[model samples]
Target: METDIVGVSEHRFDGGLLAATRRFEAAADVTREVGAGSVGVAHTLIALARMPGGVAAGLFARQGIPPDVLAAGLPGGGAGQASDAGAPRLGRLPVTAGLRAAFDAAAATARVDERVLLIALLARLEAGAVDLLAGYGRVDLDAWLTEVKAGRRVGDVFGPDGAIDPAAFGPGASRVLAVTVTEAGALGHERYGIALLLHALATTPGGLLEQAYLFLRRDVRALREQTLTLAGSRPRAGRGPAPERAPVPDEPVRQVL
Candidate 1:
């Protein structure tokens, strides 16, 4: 519950948390522009839905979000005009107690497993979080929130089994890390957040989640190339192509009668 110098509660600003914070700020800007005069979950979802076709947007589309709905929800002023030149408008968008609690919980859960950051965002229903999730077909939002409230172990939001080891980020997750760094670099940011992770999941080297995207885009070659690239980078352990299997010493062809 300790607030940082900026007056917001302290949380892990390393990876996805940083990203979510930035998006929250942007959401507040949108709220201001739309004359809502306060930041809330509705603004956050609308901001996320406007990711311009990346893993972030794909996250929503997978849940059957219609483009028209997003269009209807977008804040109407000139989008993407928020700049870093002046001091941040943080004073205008005060972080509520609910949001601070969510941040604290996300930080604690993320310590065990960073991937569950999304779940933290979903756990709190205030600010249109549940409504946004329902838009993405989260029929079990109540159950999920309950589990989070009960202090369940952090794991994949969509996984059916027990908790997965957070340290064991899959191939897709590694790609997400790389892409996130790349995105932060592009933005001249020293750190990254969930937005970049979402973008990465929507684009290059997506694991299972990309299946739907590939089906829609029909870009199998890119996926194949990505797989090959990861496979190729693996250590051979002093093994060299299995010695080409010695060409199997072809037997002389028997003359067919």
Candidate 2:
């Protein structure tokens, strides 16, 4: 599909998710600030999820993805560097092809139907992600999104000048944009957000984003059966026959901030 990506000629899902993920990674690479470096998509999503009433944050909290855990993935606050104020600045990290592929899958799965990747993330339901959404009680995907988005619009994180200023993005802005823009693209029929969520799940692996996507896309009951069958086939941990391993439901569906 042809998309209207900013600062790019043709439509590319990478523009949305890739750009944001790279920015966050870049932020982590530099700025010796505490709770900041080696940032991952999961870390960024957790940051945005923490946004007031943010879907990802709520879900992450429910699934036991703590702030400290997310913080650990971020760069340090220049601990013990108070004396060396003349430290050289860090440079930006470039986006990778693997990240781009992940976003592509997510966008394709959502079929470019969603606007908010956060909403989509919650709705998707991968294993880890399901744990978070589980407490919500029989989620109505569309209704849930409406409630979360109530009276709000997608705001620009850019500064007054039409420039891609890294400073303005702040701490975990890279992660936040990763999901937010994809949401925008989903709504705008842009491929970026679709790609963003896709990429998030891949980077996160068994993390919340992947779980959420699995839950939303797959058949819950059938998956339960499959999970059980696989578990039963495994050898016991210590006993004659290890008790049948509980099947963790692996449903595939569809993310946000």
All candidates: TM-score:
0.40, 0.27
**Per-residue C-alpha lDDT of model 1 across residues 1-257, encoded as one tens digit per residue:** 44451223344333333343353565666566555534444454455444443233445555566534643454442123332333233436544444444455666643512234435555544533444455545546566446434543333322232212222342234455555445444443443344344455555543444666666877656654464343232333533342211111011100100
Candidate 2 per-residue lDDT over residues 26-52, each given as its tens digit: 334432233433222333344344443
The whole-model lDDT of each prediction reads: 0.43, 0.35
In terms of lDDT, which candidate is strongest? Answer: 1
Error of 2 at 12 (Å): 9.3
How high a TM-score does candidate 1 get? 0.40
Model 2 has an lDDT value of 0.35
Estimate candidate 2's RMSD in Å: 22.8
